[model samples]
Target: MTPQWLTSIQTPLASAFYKRCGSKEKAKADERVAVIRDNSQQIVASLRLRRIGGHWLLRALLVDPQRRQQGIALQLLQFVGAQNPEPIWCFPYPHLQSLYHQADYQLVAEAPEPILTAYNVYLNRQPLLLMCCNR
Candidate 1:
């Protein structure tokens, strides 16, 4: 479903969206549509399907801090995976590697330039696992 603010490029949604993903930096929100789940008047979870260069990237997946361990993220990942059978790429934290593996994403030694470049700039110099789902 589309959020009304998402249609406007300069809306507060961009900042709010990245904040939801725990990011302080801005993103190109106009590049793709996001899937979100709301509870009452609050947004609980969200995931975006982004096109970077020629590839589809699963980006900015986040679940509210209060909603962790409830399988929401898994469901969202599955939904995104089912929607596109083509390969999708992501750079997930090392701890989430196994979870993405269960969703059919396998770690890759090499990634596309955009992904690789982004990985290098990821916060805290945190090690990220580059994975791809080749469904």
Candidate 2:
């Protein structure tokens, strides 16, 4: 039931976890990873909070396929939100708006510089929702 939020996600478990989510990038110093694992040490949920231009970007929120429908993602969201009062930006799918809303995140019309650039790129590819949790 214990989870970890660390600056490095280079561990074998983390690598495999991200791979399962279809993203396999090298861990950067500016990124922090949060992981919650099952009793067997298998990752059940995970997300990364990356500091971009002084803003925290939330991404890669992956919950195990078998573990969906549970509150694992919400739990992780709450954990991160509590860890710091800074605003966290996330670009999730439209369907996930309610999920992020439950974590006290509100829809935002615009984003800051670097993130706005990336957001536009994502918007072009798919329908997404941009939200921010300002604490």
The best candidate in terms of lDDT: 2
Candidate 2 has what TM-score? 0.85
Specify the poorest-scoring 10-residue window by lDDT in model 1: 1-10
Tens-place lDDT digits, model 2, residues 11-106: 456667878767764345457888888899778888888887888888888888888888898888889888878889888887888999998888
What's the distance in Å from true for residue 67, model 1? 0.6
Pairs of colliding residues, candidate 1: none
User: What TM-score number comes out for model 1?
Assistant: 0.71
**Which regions in candidate 1 have their CA more than 4 angstroms from the true location?**
1-22, 25-29, 39-41, 120-124
Q: What is the lDDT of residue 26 in candidate 1?
A: 46
- Cα RMSD (Å) per model? 3.9, 2.2
* Tens digits of per-residue lDDT for model 1, 14-102: 44756866866344645454445464545566656667677787776777787778777776677777767777888787788777877
Candidates in order, TM-scores: namely: 0.71, 0.85
> Which whole-number lDDT from 0 to 100 does residue 49 have in model 2?
81
